[model samples]
Target: MHLKKLTVVALSACFGLSACQKEEAPPAAPPASEAPAPARAESAPQQPVESMPPATATAPGSGSNLIREPVAAQEQPLQAIQTKMGPKESVIHLTSAKVTGQILTVEFVAVPKKRGDGRYEWLNLTLPLKNVSYIDDATAKKVSLLQDDGEAYMASPLNGTGKSIRLDGHSPITATLKFPAPPETSPTISVNFSDIGSFDGVPVSR
Candidate 1:
């Protein structure tokens, strides 16, 4: 049996547990310091590699330090669901689950209902922090996030620079997570998020 070996760090664990419910809900209007900067124009994202190093943190005012751009999230997800994250009502959209070589990349977006202030607040989607994993429908085995040789998770980091990944209260938040490829016989899996719920029958593509 494959164990759930990805240990959630204290800071990340705080975002996933109910005990930190208060922290999950951002302020009605995000503080200016917490706002995401404008995304600089860049070349289209290159194909993903088998592994990637953790993003290096820079001075607080510097922009995002994400190593690569994620695949553009689709206008429509393969599946979507509504759920509550703390006091906020949010929708989780599962966009794509594609296999490339030995890696399976899962992309999703989190859309929160506009706060009374009419602005979205930051939402943390750091995979490792949330104990995100998936179960193969065929074998009933759990698969954890892929990590590099140095043991750093290959998923996108918080805000692309922080210790954990956070979605700025820009528009909806899109996140990509990498995992080991599933069994050849399995064409779908159930993705499990810590405090968020599980999404089953999620189709897989090669």
Candidate 2:
């Protein structure tokens, strides 16, 4: 009888304690991500993308003319010389190379080729770089390929140079061109080059 009485008292006490305890509310849900494109987020700096490389070509003659420019001993033996807006003549070996006012001068290295009899031929062709195909991907408003031939050719008139070209019969060139600035679309000027002739007194086929 006493055990039964004690059990009832304990149950009554637990019920009383439970009635005094407070209930907790559920936690708030996470904020939705439908965020508006914030203007500068109040305070954050911007960043730009960037990778670049410099480029350069050889001059008219001498060590850089051919022998040492590309690699080891000169490969092509200079042959005939032809010009589009300049002079055309049977040029001998490369005599001398000099850069003046940005124009590279290639003087006859060998005695000018002789006529059937004995006279020499005058040169007339300008180096060819105009036909070089390139694509202008720069921000420059416009881009152009200046041809030594007295004209400029562009892959796209609004803004372009050349995307690709086959200057050398077997050498296909593909590249993107970059210009300095505006209306001067002519991003760069250049010439087609070849060196197939007599080297060190030996007649070599071009």
Candidate 3:
């Protein structure tokens, strides 16, 4: 019994049983093609696999694809939250998606730092969109592009090499989401938010 919104009600029942197909709202993170790219974070970030105390995520089991919902989503229980983010507790708690139940991912690395001294440095990022378009920027921050029936879907202009971008905060940086065609059997339901790594800020050069 857990389903905050079940990926927008299972993507509006897979685009069909729609009475009007109006329920868009999930786009905020678009603008980064060139201008602001200086947090190179050499290397650091590793001691974080010693787990044995962190639980509180139930609901995600109706059969498969996992996205169940009946009622379950109040959040804030997994060890109280915040797994890493010093100097002010930026926000951490990276990734967790129980192939059959939980789906926890918290991250907001604005400028977090702490490498070489540790081993796990990161500015990670992970979301949805198997077919993308929109890549090039200075970051003023104001993303918007939803479509499950609702509307609003524009951005999609940065690719062709600027797409294979890299963050190297320790590893991780993949992009590509801006579909319109060539997609009919891959996006039945998707929703993600990842970047877990960094609780101590530093490295700023905008």
Candidate 4:
């Protein structure tokens, strides 16, 4: 009977020890997808952005970085005499004068007098002739310049209106005369057209 009682006690002790070990065991591991992620490193501070300089604007139609300059005034032409001449009411009008380098240009207009028939009948034709014989022809041939010091310069036919003198009584004939340049210091000069009077006190300019 004692042997039977000792066997039951030993079996009871073994069952109690197994139940305590089961209660003290660790929990089961979680799945790989449900695991906690690692921490991220902190980002560096942002740097300040640099600004560019503004570009300069230039004038329209001008080169870059260049300023437009003002233009200078132009040289003006010289003046001349405008008047009548001769007893027959012929006229000689000086329009302008210009000196360039060594040449002198003189622009003028000449009007011839109307002819009368023996102091009675007016010889004025019904139609003005395309070409007329007039006193300006003599004037053109003998036109000259008398300087302040009495030095005379003849008209240069090569550079001026040659021997061709056209006269129309209905309207004045415009002509240009070229001459050798006179001394710049000449205070005054006279333009003489023989049988057609003279233009005195013409001031000289360089």
- Could you say which candidate leads in lDDT? 1
- Between the candidate structures 1 and 4, which one is better when assessed by lDDT? 1
Candidate 4 lDDT trough over 10 residues, lowest sum: 126-135
How do all models score by TM-score? 0.52, 0.18, 0.16, 0.36
Pairs with backbone N, CA or C atoms under 3 Å apart (clashes), candidate 1: 157-165, 158-164, 158-165, 158-166, 159-166
Rank the candidate models, highest lDDT first: 1, 4, 2, 3
The candidate that achieves the highest TM-score relative to the unseen native structure: 1
TM-score of 3: 0.16
Error of 4 at 67 (Å): 43
- The residue-by-residue lDDT of candidate 4 on 1-206, one tens digit each, is 99889999999999989987776553433444345432121222222112222222223436532433332122343233657464346556766556678766666665556556423222221211112111122223332332223232232222223233334445445665556555565444555554455565555455
Give the per-residue lDDT of model 2 (tens digit) for 5-91. Answer: 999999999987776553321222223333433545533433321111112222334545555767543466544332222123333
lDDT of 4: 0.46
Off by over 4 Å in 4: 1-82, 112-161
Clash pairs (backbone) in predicted model 4: none
The global C-alpha lDDT for each of the candidates, from Candidate 1 onward, is 0.66, 0.33, 0.30, 0.46
Query: Which stretches of candidate 3 lie above 4 Å from their native place?
Result: 1-113, 116-128, 131-191, 194-206
